[model samples]
Target chain A: MNLAQPIYARVKDHILAQIRSGALVAGSRVPSENELVSQFSISRMTANRALRELTADGFLSRVPGVGTFVREATPRTSLIELRNIADEIASRGHHYSSRIEDLREMMATPNLIDDFELRATTPLYHIAIVHEENGMPVQFEDRYVNPFCAPNFLKQDFSHQTPTAYLLSLLPAEELEHNVEAILPDANQQRRLKISSSEPCLSLHRRTWSGGHVVTSATLIYPASRYALYSRTSLGKQTS
Target chain B: MNLAQPIYARVKDHILAQIRSGALVAGSRVPSENELVSQFSISRMTANRALRELTADGFLSRVPGVGTFVREATPRTSLIELRNIADEIASRGHHYSSRIEDLREMMATPNLIDDFELRATTPLYHIAIVHEENGMPVQFEDRYVNPFCAPNFLKQDFSHQTPTAYLLSLLPAEELEHNVEAILPDANQQRRLKISSSEPCLSLHRRTWSGGHVVTSATLIYPASRYALYSRTSLGKQTS
Candidate 1:
């Protein structure tokens, strides 16, 4: 630790280091204010300041009654709106429909645990739905839900509504984070989307949060030939 | 025109047909209220309703004192927020720099004309800049500016400032549109980004509108290995 740096900044860096090194995983509680103060030999104010700043920076999530925990690094705040595919198709005067390919309760794998910030072997709701516009597949949505966020997730009939819509009703989303990627889909996705392997896909990874807990994480695959992910710059200070 | 449709709906469809059939290009003036009334044998109210609806739907841009004209079809509202690359690098505590590869005034190509919603052969300012973080190339930004939006665009030296910064200073953008794609970059883009053909590039196409005119159009290419576009969804009613 650099003695010249502020005590709070140093404390913040220490927790950040643990996160970077994977010593602390998502959903794992951080050292409390008292623990940090004693361990770092810092004042209570300094330790508190560090934790507060980390939460503001999206590195930590402090539950009101619960303890502060590491946030899933990939699921930061979203800059893109999570629009329902049904609404997008309906806006264009097209018939919108969805076929649920898979919806089941499964044990969380390592990947799912990391994405949902849950413990290994936690029961998660896995769903795969293909959204169609005018009888043509346009989007293949694969999603996983944290059982804690929606305890009745696996019981819902998804054909009557989208998973997103159902989750929003349980707890209105307060925050969203997204990543956009382009790749060639696998055989299953290619077959479902009716696109050749040569065609590129626009994949959108989205995570939603409500009440300081991760609601769900999803990867939506779209045929680049038909759909696009769009956003605009608002008038304000240009900051990342 | 379908007789069952409303008068304004029929009028809107007729103009939409002309635009679809290539009879009306971007920036081409739509028929005036009087002309539409006379040509379509509709009342002034019906003509006005059709024009207003088209403008609201993004098919037309209406200048306050001037006539309404067709919009570039692809530049619809964005779903992602555009952030300055410099800020993104800076937030990571890394040095950010940009190298100006090309900056010149050129006659608009057919594609450029369509993108800018300008007349054929209209002069546009073209710029290509490579943004680096810690001296490593991360983004290759190719842009075209409407001379009408920034008449003195050629006079600025971008080495000291970013094109985005300068453009925002000229006109505070009122609207933004973006399309995100994943693709194999061309030879020039590959050379600038210092990536190989096997590497996929995340390409972001953007357009800005202010005062009812397109200010600029740009394609920002980044190596997927080095960079990703991220956005946070704001809490609101989800709409394009």
Candidate 2:
């Protein structure tokens, strides 16, 4: 701890470091001001100021009656740019993992064929995976890849590499289309995401194109309670 | 309409033109296949192609046993950028209006003082507005302005110029921070937006800074059923 800063500033930094180190996680209770005061041998006012500043800065959320808790690092809104979940989690210095629910060859429906500009009933690769950050599920990714775009898509080891990373390695996408909606999750989605029926989800419908051919289509769903899509751009640029 | 393209292509262009011209609005039914066939003196296949392709391209949405409707022009996920709603509606050629619910000076609460970095009880401008696109409510903007930054904030006519527009004109923002969440709206928000309780909303919490001073903080809410946030950017650039 730096001796230059004020007592309250140092206390704020201490709590922030704990949050950054993952010793504190979202929804976990923080130490009460009395505890901080006792530990640091500081006045109660200093402890209160530290906690108040952190809450104001968004690192913590305080319920009036209940105690303060670590705020979930809200996921950046995926509306602006396509981001890989594994990368996002890793950037936060958290553990990243995925549960592969299904990966197999499937016949493209008429609608799928239209999307890929392929003939009817063509073979396509389908994959469904649940992405986790620090062992907690955060996103359920359901995806379909055109066989014509990547024939060996099913053979990739997705446990170590994300589908998004793998696909981008195959070819950097030239164009991308996105649709973001807040929806009530289906029972299956709810189960996979470990969310209740009352909880809505932010569902992102996305498609990527490479070399003038549709490469993949995906539906990524995040439980509203766990994540919030975020973006920052110049004004007048449409963003959710 | 250009005569060079195929008849069905022309029909598709016609509908698109109507949408662009604001003759057709979101949730409003599009001309049925039979109606298009009769109007254009074309075969049913051509009419069907036009509607089907439009649906596929996202300009329209179809429902069985009901009819096709003009899709809500999904706000481009300004993941890479922040976009103004008034500009978006104007670009679509739709009539844009705002109902100012509240615009007055108010004392900053403890939390507001922290957010604005002001002394407690400092006068701040607060505004509550419902923005409409083609006479349909789309966004409810609840904003608080730092009077220290814009002293004449309340003097501006918000109807002719949006708060965003007004603020932006005062000074180009140096930085913007955004948090986007899908939430179940409160009863007051539900009534103002004219949406059902079951419907979720995309809520955006945004703050802007200019010249190293906090300019504004706002909560913008959009009904999930009526609006979908969208964005398109290069791969790997994180967006909401």
Candidate 3:
């Protein structure tokens, strides 16, 4: 390491330690360029480098004319991992269960054909389930399965085990596509989740594929106040 | 195509078309199982299946005692795609420009070493640039670069091109990890973005790597009222 390396790192570490120690809370402004230079006995250029880098990494916020300040951190959740809702709930030490709202074997429409990549008028299975954590409804899962992927889907009862678990056990996929977002809940969701009309909902949309076949596609909705998604990634790891 | 397939698909398509066409607006209650059964002239089981699947797909919301309603169609935005803010502004026919608030080269700390998977005390470059659209500040971009990835990072001028565009030209990676969430902007962000304290901000966190080398990581913050993320996916093919 060069002589300048230690000085630069110490300054960066000092700022991060203050953040972790809560000496600097979210939205609180930090010292100016001149102040940092004087405090660290470093050149103005080096002080500027530390603050600028921190801002880019999301630890600090900078505005022109105004000084820099600490930033509130947002949870970084991964969408690629295909985890079951029941398992996710159970992992948190909460009792998890699902109520089978509806289930049936049916034929596909043009859209379903397109969505599931099925031949015209192919047979498919549909299921509706509300997964609960600690007796509270947390996820409304609606899913469609290509019958070819799980021929005996309707024979299995979902009350004891979720469709996700059953399918993951029966067939596992190598590739998956995931999408997630938030929006206002509708009257029905508001009532079913026991939330009000004003509450927002976090929604997840996912599709799984294996061997050039579409296994299943599902949309899961949750009351925002009750649920959150989380994920972690190493630096330079492409997350798609 | 089997007889059951057309019936299953028509009902699903009709409902989605209605929602997309705005015939069924957000928050409006959808027809009941009984109503759908009568309108579609299919078995009650078929109508039930359609509504059940739609609800699971996030196109509808259902309550036990109340009724089913159209879910607010919130678009899911993919974080993996690196979007250019300036291009986004230009697409909207607005003039976009950026001001270089701070830019300098520095040495990496322990955290950076772990994050970028680098040896202790490596040299790195850091840059902070606030992007504006039509004279209104919209994004605060903070970035860190592994000098090993882009040796001449500091030599490039950012007054004209964003670091994102610059990096994209230098290293194109096959994989990406992206995280998006809502947060309260700090005092510095509020001042630079010209947003009031009452408004929330949407934060997009991204980390990109190529061939196991950490290129860059960034967190882009935008005021909530002005921005929303959008994404879509499809089930392409079914394989047995």
Candidate 4:
């Protein structure tokens, strides 16, 4: 018992230590404020504050008219990050490999005008690569790049480095946007990913910008069973 | 032309006008830097800079040996904002409705011990709701609440307000987390959402925290064809 600390804090710490030490397990009733005042020779307000603070902190739960009990532990807050697929697999201690299916410089079409903001006949490089982890096909990537951003895109040796890695090395994305959809794989996607038609796939379309220019627009499809996305956002400043 | 501005900016604005006015149509070639230098009596470097900056801003594309042509318009930068579902529907000018499938108090299970970090016997409030737009089922919501956070969760009249609205009114989430996956709905989910088994669904699991305590954990399921998620993230400060 640190005498320098406030009386309420000392009481809270004592209860916390008991809970941490497994003496007060989850859902087990905690000492009532009256019981705490009698046991510790403290005022009712001091005992009440300790329990109230603990309840608000998730260390305990208060059932009105019933009793306060130890709360269950909650999940830790997640960290949301946008990372390259190859690096993601590597960090998992798995080998990353890719097979390039197609690479070409094609004229942009009308529909692509919306995605790339380029006129038709504008030369854009398109590439398709199947990313594998531990010999299993996990993602199929289809991408279109503005040739002005990566003039040597089609000529790069992708077997040694992924396109995402190459792009990041040259022009790092200053802005990123994602449109996610739940999809049933098309026959071509199923064949490339080796998935059944019934299996749902996560299709993530990502666009990156660098130096105020659209760098790349890419679609990566992953089998849902193999991958899930986690994102954490701060809402502390929002009012409505 | 504004003579006070740099000569290069004047030339760039001239070309931008033609492009924006439909005189220089999409895929049409722009005057070469040499032509611009001679035509405007400007320095070659100035002409070069004007074209280079235009290309970088997605106004034109240079096809190496070919020539610089107007580029397609790219999608505008997206703003990522989190919003409530009922509000989202109302903003679309659609009538929002809901059916409360089940609302009860239950004991936490061993598996949920990881999610809520509570003992198995910890009491939690559970609710299942089917959300409709114009009488068509669109989403199935299942949620578990910490009784300490919302003791009246099961007693609320969901017909007038969503559980999300009720919770947000009492406790504003300081931190929000999401786990998104593509899935085929189980029989119960399918029946509740009134969807075919073959249809794909987007499953979004969300958890919110307020005052350092977990407020609620919810799973929202939407049909893939009917819903998609958009998120924009800033990557300016990231190095790796």
Candidate 5:
């Protein structure tokens, strides 16, 4: 009856609302394509499309010749090791958003020069981004780049393309060095992530090397309570 | 000279003391073998063996033409990815210690039977251990095992060796499942780890599979501030 929204969206939302609100539990059969078509006065194709998309997005699982059932809500988590954060979130069928908090060119500091082995006078590009999933901020990324490694670094709209994606699109890193640490968040981090001050944070520091040069050094901070890196796939090198 | 300690240990202690105390900084060359042989009135082989052991232990880097120099103090961290914790710490030249908190044979709970897909009323082996490094506690391990998988599970002395080492010795896992989470320390965990209650802990859960069965499920928890997982080695898949 809501004419403002499209018919397909309205139908999808009506079914999704039931699933999310626990009206339809996992393994419970969803409305059949015919039932949906007749109940909503929608075409058969529209009902099929809604179910198909829902299955693709992991909301439902369809058994051939049988009916579709609500699925368990545990999303397959991202492979967080040196992965592009945007692509990782998108793969799980979640909305991905980024806020470019700071981006500018600055002279390489002593620590950068020492760690990155850059010349003292070499100018560097610094970028800070807050990445969110479904409107909740999860990670804060602070990255520094070597100008020679990525020229024209400052011109792009990061909202459209992430810095990591753009960098990989230009050239994949030959080597990645990663270090993970746990720390208590400061006041500013608490505000940015909207987490409690007592929250512990997992800080992942990564160095990307390309063409025998340190291309970029990034520090990604995540509220430990909100997110974690997980893996379950096997390498297939089995014993026994 | 202290008569109680052996000569080689004295020589090693002297050199190590300087390096650890920052009396000799990184890249600073140590006294030559001949000079050590004369200064301590020791044999040529004693000096050579001490230097060689130091190089092997990562305290010094020896160049063929140049003399041995104090190395950077950053120890190559243990590969924490389902690695044998004892070997990992040994590889980093640190003392590894484990306290067996609890080990017993018990009936599998409903949750364990559900998560592990075991038959109800099956007996399970439960183990709790606190792993320490350099006299500091770092990780607390809680584990459950299917007795049919490792029939002699209760006989091993975990103090001399780790439970992981024993399980892996019997049969290498065909599949491994890992999940990581962050949580504030509970009173029990804080007491076991000797960490403040406010500290956040990184909890890694692992399931090891063999012969299409989950042999062991382990929950390893570490105080975030004290230890971290680090890697600087390359995978060697080149780009650019």
Candidate 6:
């Protein structure tokens, strides 16, 4: 904020402006350090600092042997962080709702027998729910539950309460794994979500465990245009 | 694999296998709980456990007023944790190399004057580099440096060392900030990265600073098909 501040920041803002204004298009190279010194009439040290900082911030790319160049701007892409969809939507001032489609108990099939390493006649509970945001369908929640993990799940009314909330109340989890991706929506999804065939959808596959048993698994689908993922990283366990 | 194990895992796997084997096509509703219980001749508890776990795993959807339905399978996407890009490619058994494109010193522009709060004529350095994996172009790095933070950067032989490695050697950082995103590849990027127009690209915009002075800023780009972003989250932080 004063004269004592380094020249690097001064130069970085200048370059960043050019980028924001499209004057410095993607892949375009800026002047070299020597050129910068002569152009700005500044010391070589100052010019070097500016470029070095810019390279580390990811606005420019420096190849050891080649030269510096402008990096392309990517939009709507961020480190995918784990977040509750309901929280995300509600924060934006939207009404969030879920309609439970079905809930029942049944016998495990042969494949289930193998996957859960269960006996031929193990029992499980299955539930399907449609999640809506602002009266528009956003995700279809297809979930499988370990009854032993949350015994009273069937008695709870999901229309006013989310399974995530209920399950957390019944059992606290120690570990969680989540996977997400983009894919084409199927016909039923298209109809339920009221999205067209041309639109791609984002899907999240999640598995959560507690007490060394698989507590729950869920597939959550979202209309691609409706959601974007966000995440941040630090050197250690810091979160922002 | 035994009776003592939970029934949920087995049922979830059974549904997944059915979907994978095309026994249950997309958009098809799965059998109701009563049907499953009768078919497997298992207790309602066992059937419920299977369905519940499968739903959580994203294999099925249940609508309370409607019925239980088979959900489309979405690819399981995972976030690529934030780390040194060089380290990432190296982990995949590849040689990574970077070419220094340009290096020079210059005066700060009007924007730089404001952002870095510098005098109108402060000096700065600009550097550019391109990173490659096994000779295949991957990331184009453009960077700006703050010379005041690392005065001897100009004298460093970047060809023999990475800017990150060199800078870290000169000054140890105590704090950092990062931003990442995805965007369509531009013409220059398409040519430099040898990616086609149809291919989307992932880009990262990062900024790191120490001691309240902006140290570095950079932008990194990668082809969409070649990479995906990932991250992990824990509940302890939120509760604590």
Top lDDT hit: 2
lDDT (Cα, tens digit) per residue for candidate 5, span A69-158:
987652222124556778878998999998888999998888898658654557899999999999999999999988887888999899
Model 4 misplacement above 4 A: A1-80, A234-236, B1-82
On residues A67-132, what C-alpha lDDT tens digit does candidate 4 reach at each position? 899886532212234467787676344678989999999888887777886655688899999999
Candidate 4, residue B239: lDDT:
39
Once model 4 is optimally superposed onto the true structure by TM-score, how far is the C-alpha of residue B201 displaced, in angstroms? 0.6
What does the lDDT come to for candidate 2? 0.81
List, residue by residue over B1-240, the lDDT tens digit for candidate 2.
555899988999899888887789898899889999899999988898789778866789887779999987755545434467898788677789999999999998888887776655788899999999889999999999998788999999999999988888787776677777888889999899999888888887888888777799999888987787676533222223
How far residue B166's Cα lies from its native spot in candidate 1, in Å, is 2.6
Model 3 error, position B58 (Å): 35
| lDDT tens per residue, model 1, B99-201 | 9999999998999878877766788999999999889998899999989889999899887778888998888767677778878778988788888776777
Candidate scoring better on DockQ of 1 and 2: 1
CA lDDT of every candidate: 0.78, 0.81, 0.72, 0.80, 0.78, 0.65
Looking at model 2, residue A230 earns an lDDT score of 72
**Steric collisions counted per model:** 13, 18, 17, 13, 0, 127
lDDT of 2 at A168: 81
Off by over 4 Å in 5: A1-79, A119-121, A238-240, B1-81, B91-94, B119-121, B238-240
Sorted by DockQ (best first), the order is 4, 1, 5, 2, 6, 3
For each candidate, the DockQ is 0.22, 0.19, 0.04, 0.27, 0.21, 0.04
Q: What is the lDDT of residue B59 in candidate 5?
A: 87
lDDT tens readout by residue for model 3, B49-89: 78876775567889998999987543322334576788889
lDDT, candidate 2, at B68: 93
Off by over 4 Å in 1: A1-79, A119-121, A232-240, B1-82, B93-97, B110-114, B117-121, B134-136, B234-240
Model 5 Cα displacement at B103 (Å)?
Answer: 0.2
